[model samples]
Target: MYLKGEDISFGYEKKNRILNHVNLSLGSGELLGLIGDSGSGKSTLGGILSGYINNYQGSVSMDGKKIPSKGYNPVQLVFQHPEKAVNPRWKMKDILNEGHAVSQDILDSFGIKKSWLNRWPNELSGGELQRFALARALSPKTKFLIADEITTMVDAITQAQIWDIVLDIVEELNIGVLVVSHEKKLIDKLCHDVVFLDDINNV
Candidate 1:
């Protein structure tokens, strides 16, 4: 399967545009990196890919069909801010179980302990909360993963651990991935191909 975003144009307001005619694609078992500055609409594009933002003028398709508007999305997104993405009222176990029941192997790979599941979102640190967010996104139904600066706030060791787990799953499932980040080394090491936002975005 292939995930494709073609000629995507979006703007916050009429006077100016953030992304213009950006084109991106990731095939099964392929890893694509999107590199750009902070406000270059990298996250916005990722949002579009995952059906988070739908006001753009373009088509996002998987294997030539339009992405489903209802039901579980084949594409999943993991954001940089764990606190903003999750429901503070729910415990970690509830959060992880919202979409699907994640495997113990996945929890182990992400370094999520059984005890952490009993705590509230505030009870855990930022890094710990992020692990839950990631586990939620890594459901079995997810075929594509868009990581929008997901490791930006974590420690180096934690970052490495997450990537190690993610890469393992990517290889195991032949999952397509889009890594959106400004870090050149991270993109270089994890991605099979790279596209700078300025090179593709007409704006």
Candidate 2:
């Protein structure tokens, strides 16, 4: 399956534009690196591609059809901040359960401890919380993953671990991944191809 965004353009206000006629595509099992400076609207494009920003101009389609307007989305997005993603009132187990039932093997692969499931979001470390976030995003129905600087807030070792788990899972599941980040080493190391925002955006 392919998620294609054609002529995507959006902005919060009329005068200022963030994304302008940006085109991008990711097929199953492919990993694409999106590199740009801060405030370059990489994350905004990711959001539009994933159906989070529906009011934007242009079109995003899965295969040849538009994405579902409701229910489970095949394109899953893992944001930079895990703390803001999950419900702080709920325990980790419940939060993970928001998606499909994650297996013990999946937890082990992401280095998520059994004990961590019982803790609140506030109780776990940033890396630990991020692991759960990744697991939740990798549900069986997910055809593509839009990782918008997911590991930027973590330490180097933790970032590596997260990326390793993500790569392994995406390979096994044949899920396409669009990694939006400013990390040059990471993009070079993980992406099959790299594209810069200015190359495709008409802005």
Candidate 1 lDDT by residue in tens digits, 16-37 = 8998888888998889999999
RMSD of each: 1.0, 1.0
What TM-score does each of the candidates earn? Answer: 0.97, 0.97
Query: Can you tell me which runs of candidate 1 are displaced by over 4 Å?
Result: none
TM-score of model number 1: 0.97
Off by over 4 Å in 2: none
lDDT tens per residue, model 2, 1-203: 89999888899888888888888989999999999999899989988988888889999999989999788889999889899999999999999988678888888889888888899999998888889998888877889999999999988987888899999999999999999999888999999999999899888
Question: Clash number for model 2?
Answer: 0
The local lDDT score (0 to 100) that residue 101 gets in candidate 1 is 86
